[model samples]
Target: MAVYKVYAPPAPPTGGAASPEHFVFVRESFSWAAFLIPLPWMLYRRLWIVLAFYCLAAVAMALLAGSELAPVSMALGVLTPFVLGFEGNALRGWSLDRRGYTLEGVAEGRRRDDAEIRFFTRWVGGHAAAPQQPTPGPAARTLPITTLRETPTGIVGLFPTAGTQT
Candidate 1:
């Protein structure tokens, strides 16, 4: 099952809540597209800051590859895609946060649409319920308290006695 982080856009300055249609569900999992083609994926997601950092890292790696640190640079180049695949969703979430989106809740399902359906069904149901006052109840009774030993009587694990060597 895939887990998704739900984000709702910021309310308008006129004081109305944002529409439900604008909510974004970001899948919390590795992205194969991000691993294979990170730049285009970031571009599609509008992750400008992450893209900028990725570009800078690419440039730095290229420069290092031409210098004495070629092996290290090559290793980093290979590792970058895996890191992008792992962190792509998280980066997207961070971008949404920066753009004034509030984290609504988490949802889980086999797919994005399924996750959205599950989340919205619960969300709407919760909001539709009316608040009720708590009914008065009988006074609670307190259980009798017991004291515990301040010190151990013996070794508590595999050893049977306190001073016995294992």
Candidate 2:
């Protein structure tokens, strides 16, 4: 299954919980297309800051290697694009975070559309009311906390432990 990290606008125009319509599912994996064409993909995604950094870094690398080791620079030139493929989605997510896009959730399916359908279908099933945007409201800094843990014996859900209080 293709894994996707779902992102939604900080504030939906309609207000309420963000619906599937407002979600952007970015595949959580390396991209061959990004590896082959970093600049084009960066431009298409409108990652201006990342693109600027990438361009400057590439140029600097070239200049530093100019009078030194040509092969090292060539290797770096070839390697950076491949690295971009691995990190492109991560960079995009970072950009989204900076732009105030909330990460609603992570989902998976065979195809992109399938992932969307599954996410919404489950969403609707879980909620008694109609779908609402996920935004809590302006001026509120919050995230819909989901499962992520370190301990091996940890449980899921809000009340994971039923142990006695001190």
Please provide TM-scores, in order, for all candidate models, with all chains considered together: 0.75, 0.69
Clashing pairs in 1: none
What tens digits encode model 2's per-residue C-alpha lDDT throughout 1-166?
Answer: 9999888767767767655566678998888878988889999988999999999988877796877777878888888987899999999998898988888777789999888877777665223244467876688877666544544546554666633233
Off by over 4 Å in 2: 12-19, 124-166
Among the numbered candidates, top lDDT falls to 1
Q: Write the per-residue lDDT of candidate 1 for residues 68-135, one digit (tens) a residue.
A: 99999999999999999999899999999999999988889998899988888778622322335686
Which clashing pairs does model 2 show? 16-133, 17-132, 17-133, 17-134, 18-133, 18-134
Candidate 2 is scored at a TM of: 0.69
Instruction: Name the weakest run of 10 consecutive residues (lDDT summed) in model 2.
Output: 122-131
